[model samples]
Target: MKSALKKKNLVVLKVKDVKRDKELYLHQREAMMALDQSIIDKENNRFAGLIVLPTGGGKTETAVRWVLKNFINQHKKVIWIAHRRELIEQAFESVEKNAITALIDKRKHFNCRIISGEHGSASTIERNDDFIIASKDSLYRGLHHLEEKWLKYHKEVFLIIDEAHRATAKTYRKIMESIDKNAKKFQVIGLTATPFRTAQYEKGLLKKVFKNDIVYQVSLRTLISRGILAQPILKTLQTYINVAEDVSEEEAQLIEKNDTIPPDIANFISKNKVRNNRIVQEYIDNKDEYGKTLIFAVSQTHAVVLNTLFHERGIRSEYVISNGTDLFGKGIISDSNKEKIKRFKENALDVLINVNILTEGTDIPDTQTVFLTRPTTSEILMTQMVGRALRGEQAGGTKNAYIVSFVDDWQNKIAWITPEKLYVGQGVWQDCENNPASFRRLLPLKQIEQFAKIADDTIDTTELEKIEFIKTVPLGFYSFSLEKTNEDGSTFNKSCEVLVYENNKTSFEKLMDKLTAYYSIPDAKGAKKLAKIFADAEDLSVISFLASFGFYSSNDSPTINLIDDVKDIVSHFEINRTAPPYIEFKEREQIDIRGIAQKVYDMELGGKKKKAYIDDVWERNSFLQAYFNHKKLYFRKAIDTELLKLEEPELYSA
Candidate 1:
């Protein structure tokens, strides 16, 4: 019996070994190939670029493999830098695990050292250390030590920056500059899920550092299609907690400026029994579906509260926070956090609740769902939180991951990051069965917020109460009805609807210019002459032009099909069409016009520049000018109000 059991154990060990020797995914291999080609190109000696892979796409593993094969096997020195301790440790472990077993030369010996606050210092970095996995903070503080100890001897080194979106930061830049000045031959490689920055200056800095090279890139949609990442299903549960009303102007400004929720607001949210109950109830209601869940709490107190609630309800749950004292003044250490994470990874714990600790660099691939119990304005932080559960079947995770967002009514005070925004252009709407209608179609959040502001400024509350409010006109489509004085002094309503695909303002401007010129001409002879000139010069067709504009009407189709004939064109314009009631149309039109003005006014431009831009649009864009001319009083008011808001926000607020 003992001999038979030994044989079975040997078979299991062999199977595990075989699984460990599995090849990289096709996309990962492509990334490696791109990296190899870039290294050999030799066009630029200092080749620096990014490997952009979506979360759960094994960016670190791909990079490690490439480095191991091309650099480590060649006995070259490499520095792997990450912002967080977890990432530094992860990189160290990855290199250690694959260095001996997976490398082409198994006999090659390499020393790997981790430099961080908790780990060893720069003084410990020996000359023979081939690989140094380091935290940016630790390296920045110990730069002199590094230079005196190891950097002075090693003039040739390769740098790999994990979570390289943050490479634009001051610490990262200073470190890179130091290395550049010290090293004789060096190459930089950045690995990141998000390669783009929010600010223009930051983006420029990133381009300057990476030499504007995106050597390899892959989209979230492509990864999901290739089964490299799980399909993310976003679900929002409204907490109905109105924190905006409780926030002061100072707090609001701080939140906006810092891109974080204020502690007072977070504390208030954490203490809300109703909100807590709902969050706990949600998990209890869907425990089976959620499976191994992770919840992002606003604070340590929130995590503790949620964990306690889950325990009360007989659920296996644990909360991990930074090494500190808990709410009850009990000391919480890092080891406890690691233990909880370990249990959660092993499926011993059903749920793991944390406060900011699990946002980045933590490998929790088996996480089936993430409950976003906190609100944040930072896109980077939001992306990190959402990435936790993105691992797919090919990555040894589930087929689908659920992103459950506990949404609060912020009352437009904070521009919260939504999961839908991450996959904006990634064809999330293409799969109808997987994504519901609510998740499929969405106006940009900025547009929605601007529309709300316009509604507040334009709509008469008492008047609105009398009738059911109609949905705002769809973006990129404008409709208006003009009351025109006929040639015989009789009155008639001329209705016009303009549809510009995807809000193509340039195309609309061209159409507007053509219409303005035709309408400005008084005599039929001049109109005919101008029409002929336009047709002959531009080869313009009236029907095709209108079709290109996405123009259509409920009442009548265009009678004129060619721009060469002036009579048919004029006849077509003269046809009466069914128009919305003039008063209602004007009211809606005012809101939309003001909304557009506000959007322009809110741009990150100086006052003079903004005013100049608005003037340029108003003068050249005939469609906008026509609307503004009709409602001159409202237009002037909107401009003055927006200008006041910009110049003297305090006065405007009052």
Candidate 2:
């Protein structure tokens, strides 16, 4: 009768039991696997590297998968560091969801303990734990708690950094140094859209800490071509005249001193009668072309002025600035910022305006247009700001994005966002470094002859092709004109065709090429292959397969041996999309260590808990390999006086 009852109670299980996302796109999988391989090949926990997945290209998911396969399933521990709460929350969510799905895939169970500033209480991450995702600040604050020797319980502790380009920050340095002194061996991996900030402090720090590790990298172009990102359409809205030229030399100095446009230009771009009128009218006119937009403003006041102008023009928009100043110019609560972000994401708002906050790790895939009212010189800032709109929409149809940028004609620059180099039309791009012929520079801009041609009414087709704007010439006016030399050897315009020196290129080409250059490919062939991959597949990091060959530098051209290494890695990617060597993060079921610890605590205190006891429980748990090295005294003093918090919630307050 019991047997019959058991048989009758059998629950039919479907093949796809857990909610698994579509198979990771090719590049995503490759990046995860490559980073996993690099970590595993580590002889003794000195593995530090970076993966350059374009923003919104699911770097979080890729990193999460690596942690699950490499650390979680293997019973190892992971520390994921990111800057923003949103980034941390998203990262933790990805890890929790995907890691659990992975465990479910193997019919295994492991309590994935994730502690972060967002929600993870100060619960002790016991010996047999899974992952810990923390904001950079929280990680810094909790470095002492993180220093507990948990590695003896697993193979290695892993530090996965988001926005890895900021690796040189003091917080990360402290955490790394803490781990270093604790004798807790760890593998450090960084995720970033860009690697180097400058050739000095940032470059050195990244190279030294990551061991010059470019473990997995997909060219940005490949990401777009693979449909991993949207292709951006760019238009340069020139101001017609340089604002500095319009003002006196003293006024130019004053503008520079104030770090803002002179009152005249500010009023023009801001609340002035003529320019503001033109801006609103043009924006309304182009409403059909550009979809939901994000305007990056120069200042708080500037953002407000623009917001008012937008509202007056009936654009159905909202602005969310970081500061608490109300729209009416009086103080307002800032708590609604998150609500505003939520509404914006839900498409309840047609346009979002902000000052300086929507740059790093902010992903709004549905954003169709990004307007630059503020320009910056830092390539990192510009890249981040521009990349915000490059994320493909969730529904995913046409992948065209647009960037409408304004140039400050008077200063011969843009206000807040300035691209160092760009592939402009008519077969030309300015020298990004501002040194036209500086041969000492490491990254020279690669040239593409016959990139584009300007049409002429007077000149012949062949002559039109020859007529091109001079590189690095300040914006406004200049052109190559067909001229005939007089007998006196002086040349005059015979068939002059004017070319506006507007630094505008089809967005896809320059963005793809610039990101491709980040890969440090061996030769132009690799770049071309990467470009084709970007053009054809959403999985552009097929070139990342070559990263395993130790091609971390563009100067290091691939040799015969390296080419073979590339082929070998390619074969691996083609077959084993999971972990390499037949062991895909094994299916071993884990003991309910957290459950056991929690239960013990419930028994020890009845209804109360101590942070020290909770933290030291891992040190006492005999299930771990570290149990042998356990301190009997520490176990007895479960609620060690050294522990600061009195309850379980305090353990993960970081």
Candidate 3:
């Protein structure tokens, strides 16, 4: 019965449309036509330009519809390039709508095929399709080794580079150069949400690859505020992870030397800032409080590690990463695999962790929490991650979304959010570090206190004070926190932080307080009975039960798992099987019992003598055997077959 109910709930979440008004505008249509004209005009010559549309702003559809219109008229060849396999598949599926419309235009139309490594023709040189949706790697390979006739015949080609910010990359650029040099008139257009170039992007090879041309940008904030997209309630949590001095030094070296991060940073961040994966893990564990989650990791390895961690905690989660062509020319993620991702999104997978693949073009509306496991210096990266969670509104009137960032490393580099101008297209915080007076200043303590006090007044102050145990701490000048929890065995103990103006503390606090009151009502409140139970015997479960009702205005939650919850609630907090750290920490002043037992086992098992015989045949090998025995004690466990057979070997004898 329980399994059936869970499955049914999953089905509803998959099919439901969180956003009611899904429509495109005249300006959007005009922009599509303008891009088509730009493409046709560039067919006379190649032009480098970017279309900066927010996520769900119909960028892919716009490109597809333009192709349908232009292809029917001029029979111009179109090659759509996607960076990732999931993106390529998504574009192909989305273009089908346009293809269906194209069928209505005439009796029969030009062929539009998905020319990926999986479904398309072996060679992309002579494809007769009007539209060829290809993965960047696959398309790049096919273009790299093009036949003479294929290049000569393909005169009027329109190349649409999705996630165009990455077009400056060598793989895409190499392909672009080939097509441009070979074809008569090749048009190039890049699409992305965030496009900012540091020295490398601006004056470096990117400048040569994609000249200064950004044609149009319709930002997420604008669409949401204008009611075109769902208005996202931006909930920010600044989780501080505390690592030991030694670990911190080691981690810093790893990041600085390698330009990559790991998942253990979650433990470090939680130790100092909030907790493991902070509010993200909580949301995953607590189904009633949080709808769905999208965790954005810093690297592919980190994403894999996070996925493992989520599975260990018994949470159903999936990960998406960028795949490149290898020597034999194969895509890392295929079309069927891309469909699996779409299915995961379609069904309400509790959590979906991605590296950089889903940052730009993928859409998953029910993702209420955006967990940032890695911190980037780019505001573009931050904006892209935040955009993923802002897709649709929650039924519980949660308009905005939640973002938990690991800023233990890049605190100074983060750009503060400006509510005033966050939604405006192409307006981002100027580099405050480079030019002083750009970064906003922190408000006075008195102002913050007054703001909190005012926030205390707006809501049910009594009820809020009742749950005052759930306290919030400001991360810095522009960030504040809100703590929340639910009665369904899930606890949100960490701070709910946000990025806003320092002086706007009062406004932010009021918003937080109102949110706290809204969610504080427990789902199943048998408070009277629980109170009686607590009074009778001071039961910890009673207090824990009450704590479950604990709520704050913050948008994130940490899903409570068996390991963490058992440790928190049990009278004796200890691991049953005793991991290394646990045993060592418990017996700090006592004897090393485990070590001694291991030593004895080593001696009894003829530890290194077994291997030493292989290396030193002529020696009076006692000395070598003793050294081997000592070394082997640390790694190998000792076993006695005869003793086990006599004592309790029924299962072991097999």
Candidate 4:
């Protein structure tokens, strides 16, 4: 007995050492460290926390590695729970693969069962079954089976919930409660990309479920910058499908409040032949640019129409829906959805259209583009749809992914979740025309919308110009202009833009208020108060505030320079002294308006056409019109060529 026990201990140590030596990405390493710490510092032998990682950031692999080392190798049981079928299958596959590498001891036998409505049963959960991958519904229904076979016997058990943003649902809560009551020692960890809840009640429930404990969190920007996830380039294709007249008041209210349109409206959009044709045409036009694509359709009919259209155009495409029937009640395509997905993963199929099936937990890392043909106001659904193509080069995917959204004219009724929301607070922008090679950055959708409005001749510019641009600052952005004297005694203007993410806006406002108050009462006591305020402010808020004054540094201990005018008020306040330990500062050049204008004017349009276009945009772009109207002389040279054409059109006639 002693010899056998010693051998078991040696196996466990061997597994731990092997798993430790395995290479983990920087974020994954940090997550593992946090999980280990959570386990060690758990109260009552129980720990519940959420792991927030963006899609394709390998949250599953990280959890599997940690569980294999800590639970499976130590002869403890683990129950991996997910609501979706794909999540359950994906979890099972990940654990199965990792277990092979970590659990090499033949003497130690372990078994895994997949319990879901379609697959294994909870009643068959054996005493020796070490790992269980189950759907929440299946596990909830079979709580008695789990309690009788394993929960009552095992003193320590680990519960991992995937797509855990839905943990507040009744089914999930019931399952967790049942397990808590049955098991003596319980630890629960939830994994999700979006931790935030839109509804107030749902937020409260989520907080209660996880004790407001987020063990480890990594942002989408962090993953992209670290090459763990791809940069998402948002492209909007206008479908020209106007359904405003078809919508009822009740439908509009439902869309605005619930983030869902009426079924009849969805069906109407799905059957629009013109809109369907445009979707297929986009794919055909950009076949080479958009390599392996996944399309989210509005309905089964929409998916079938798109798939048939692609096939008619001699493109390799397939569509999958929940049911095995076409819109006409005919049988589905010869190949099953799973088989089609397999072919898509193998690169045999260029495009795979689905109706709400591939949104969550379906791992298609090689998808280079995603066609969001269906409009949604739900941020969670939008995130999941876009995340399908977010796998990075380091993770065996491309460096850049394209999120092509089919935008329709909704008469500004529904506040749809555009692809720009992903980078609203991320402080990343890519001007494709200016810097095509730089995939790490992203241009905000608001800017794109502004430009589109300027170019749209149908929209009356007179009404648009009346609206104040100041009232509509892009989300998470603050912009101001500063003029500095050059060595030659001339002044050059620089536009300063700072990004205060949505989550940090409240703190940023508070910091600004405190600074404003301190400016009114400039004294050593006020300086101390300001210093305390800065200390309490979030790091991002402090960075944004400093950035407002042209101090753009990302260093841990950056030396901040105050403007000459505000020096007296903040003379006693040590800006550098209040920076957080992890604050990074990097110098960035300010935007040169003249240079940008020159580049815009350098486009291929002829003199007369360019002049007309510039004049049209000038009248339409409210912000530019306002600024240029006030400082017409200052920026006259920037648009001199266009103005010259207007004065002497005969000299430069098309």
| Reference-based TM-score of each model | 0.52, 0.44, 0.40, 0.50
Ten-residue segment with the worst summed lDDT in candidate 1?
9-18
Best by lDDT: 1
Cα displacement (angstroms), candidate 2, residue 461, comes to 46
lDDT tens readout by residue for model 2, 62-147: 78776676666565567777765446655644654564554435536554444444344323445555566666665566565565
Give candidate 1 regions above 4 Å deviation: 1-26, 37-50, 72-219, 248-260, 311-316, 325-349, 359-364, 378-380, 426-504, 507-654
Query: Taking the tens digit of each residue's C-alpha lDDT, what string does model 4 give over 399-473?
Result: 899988887767555556656544443334323223311111222323334434534557553333322232222
Residue-level error in angstroms, candidate 2, position 398: 3.9
Instruction: State the lDDT of candidate 1 residue by residue for 1-654, as single tens digits.
Output: 223212221100110121246577889889988987888555345778899987557788899978877787777888999865446656764665566445546434666667775565676667777778887877888888778777889888899999775676667889998888888887899998754532333234456678747889887788887766788877766676888887877777567545567778788999899999999999899999888999999888999899999999999999998876432122344887889899999999998999767876568888999999987755556767887888887787778888888877665555455676444434452332123222212222332333344446565433222111122232333333233344543223333333323234344455555544443323345446545544555554554555465443221211212242322333332221111111112223333444544566667655788667766656654434333322334344455555555555665332
User: lDDT per residue, candidate 3, 1-654, as tens digits?
Assistant: 223212221110111122232345644766776775665555547676677776556677776666656654365677788755446656755554455433224424555545454554326344454566776666665664443535567876777888665565556777787888887777677777654342332243334555636667666656665554545433333343433234455565444333344556544442332344554466655555556677766566666767776787777777777686322122256565476578667764677876656665555666666776665533334556676765544222235555544334232222233321233233332222121111112222322232234244354323222211112222222222111234542212221122222233344345334323322232224323433444545456543543443422232221112222222221110100110111001112221223333444455535476445323321343222221221222112121222232345353423
Compare the candidates by TM-score and give the number of the best one.
1
**Which structure is stronger by lDDT: 2 or 3?**
2
lDDT of 2 at 52: 78
Q: After superposing candidate 4, which stretches have Cα over 4 Å from the reference?
A: 1-30, 37-52, 64-222, 248-263, 311-314, 324-334, 342-348, 360-364, 377-380, 426-615, 618-654
Q: How far out, in Å, is residue 308 in model 1? A: 4.2
Q: What's the distance in Å from true for residue 397, model 3? A: 9.6
Q: Model 1 misses residue 277 by how many Å? A: 2.5
Task: lDDT winner between 1 and 3, please give it.
Answer: 1
The clash numbers for all candidates, in the given order, read: 0, 20, 29, 12
Q: What overall lDDT goes with each candidate model? A: 0.63, 0.50, 0.46, 0.62
